[model samples]
Target: MPKKVPIRKCVGCQERKEKRELIRIVRSPEGEFSVDPTGKKPGRGAYICPKLECLEKAIKNKGLERSFKTAVDDELKELLRQKVTSYEK
Candidate 1:
């Protein structure tokens, strides 16, 4: 039997991609945001590509804000940038 690969859409490009190929951002019930690498965090989640371009587009388009249903201000944006870069290493 063949196992099915999970698919998710990128909030930045709105493109469908394999789940393992993207990064996930989660908003805890307590309204805290974190970049989810293990993809096992319990919370509302939004997916984005790991590319910087996608991150920029997501920010400019307010994709994260829409996904999280909250204000994604400068501080959080900077945090996301740092976490993403660290993850890439």
Candidate 2:
């Protein structure tokens, strides 16, 4: 039997898509934010599409903040933008 694929919602576009098709942003137990390419990192994770528009939408809509349940400051947001921009296709 085929393995069941996981599903994740993009914090950016708010779209429900297969987990593999999205990029994951993980907040480690130490409260560190980083991108999880493998999608298996053990921590709170938020997903976003591989698109710049979605990134902007997420920032503007406070989607990431809601997902992480914390205030995402300007520096962190800038850092996230840099990391996510590289992942954009």
Best-fitting candidate, scored by lDDT: 1
Clashing pairs for model 1 are: none
> Against the unseen true structure, what C-alpha lDDT does each candidate score?
0.89, 0.86
Mind giving the per-residue lDDT tens digits that candidate 2 earns over 1-89?
Answer: 99999998999888999998888888888998888888789999999888888889999999999999987778777877787688763
Candidate 1: 10-residue stretch with minimal lDDT:
80-89
Candidate 1 whole-model C-alpha lDDT, 0 to 1: 0.89
TM-score winner among the candidates? 1
Clashes by residue pair, model 2: none
Q: Write the per-residue lDDT of candidate 1 for residues 1-89, one digit (tens) a residue.
A: 88999999999999999999999999999988888889999999999888877888999999999999998878878987886676667
lDDT for position 78 in model 1: 93
Query: Following a full C-alpha superposition, what root-mean-square deviation does model 2 have from the true structure?
Result: 1.5
In angstroms, how far off is 10's CA in candidate 2? 0.6
